[model samples]
Target: MDIGVGFEITYAARRAQRLSNVVLAKARTHTAESIDCER
Candidate 1:
C-alpha cells in the first residue's frame, strides 16, 4: 500500500512539472512576441 501511494505521488509530481514547463514555454513565447512588436 505504501509503495502504491508513493507511485501516485511521483506521478502527480511529474504531471505538475510538465504542466508548469508548458506554461513557462508559452509565457516566454508571448513575451518574445510582445517585445518584437514593440520594436
Candidate 2:
C-alpha cells in the first residue's frame, strides 16, 4: 500500500511539472507577441 501511494505521488509531481512547463512556454510566447505588436 505504501509503495502504491508513493508511485501515485511521483506521478502527480511529474504531471504537475509538465503542466507548469507548458504554462511557462505559453506565457513566453504571449509576451513575445505583445512585444512585437508594440513595435
Candidate 3:
C-alpha cells in the first residue's frame, strides 16, 4: 500500500506538469497573437 501511494503521487505530479505546460503554451500563443495584431 505504501508503494502504491507513492506511485500514485508520482503519476499525479507528471499529469500536473503536463497540464501546466499546456496552459502556459496557450497563454504564450495568445499573447503573441495580440502583439501581432497591435503592430
Candidate 4:
C-alpha cells in the first residue's frame, strides 16, 4: 500500500472515465444528427 501508486491508479481511472464520457457523448450526438436528417 504505497501512497504514490495509489494516487497514480486513481488518476488513471479518472482519465479513463472522462474519455469514455466524451466518446459516449460524441456517439449520441451523431445519432441525433442522423435522426434529424431522416425527419
Candidate 5:
C-alpha cells in the first residue's frame, strides 16, 4: 500500500511539472509576440 501511494505521488508530481513547462513555453511565446507588436 505504501509503495502504491508513493508511485501515485511521483506520478502527480511529474504531471504537474509537465503542465508547468507547457504553460511557461506558452507564456514565453506570448511575451515575444507582444514585444514585437510594441516595436
Candidate 6:
C-alpha cells in the first residue's frame, strides 16, 4: 500500500513537471512572436 501511494505521488509530480514545461514553451513562443511583431 505504501509503495502504491509513493508511485502515485511520483506520477503526479512527473505530470506536473511536463505541464509546466509545456506552459514555459508556449510563453517563450508568444514572447518571441510579440517581439517580431514589434520589429
Candidate 4's residue-wise lDDT over 1-39, tens digit each?
999999999999999999999999999999999999999
* Tens-digit lDDT track of model 1 for 1-39: 599999999999999999999999999999999999999
Shift of residue 28 alpha carbon in model 3, Å: 0.4
Model 4, stretches more than 4 Å misplaced? Answer: none
Q: Which stretches of model 2 miss by more than 4 angstroms?
A: none
The superposed Cα distance between candidate 3 and the true structure at residue 13, in angstroms, equals 0.4
RMSD in Å for model 5: 1.1
For residues 1-39, what per-residue lDDT tens digits would candidate 5 score against the true structure?
A: 599999999999999999999999999999999999999
Task: Assess candidate 3 and give its TM-score to the true structure.
Answer: 0.91
Distance from true position, residue 12, model 1, in Å? Answer: 0.3
Clashing pairs in 2: none
Give the number of colliding residue pairs in candidate 5.
0
The lDDT of each candidate is 0.99, 0.99, 0.99, 1.00, 0.99, 0.99
Candidate 6 lDDT tens digits, 1-39:
599999999999999999999999999999999999999
Q: If scored against the real structure, what TM-score would every candidate get?
A: 0.92, 0.93, 0.91, 0.91, 0.91, 0.95
**Residue 10 C-alpha lDDT in model 1:** 97
Could you say which candidate leads in TM-score? 6
Write the residue-wise lDDT of candidate 3 on 1-39 in tens digits: 599999999999999999999999999999999999999
Per-residue lDDT, model 3, residue 37, is: 100
Off by over 4 Å in 6: none
- Which 10-residue span in candidate 1 carries the lowest summed lDDT? 1-10
Question: lDDT for model 3, on a 0 to 1 scale?
Answer: 0.99
Best by lDDT: 4
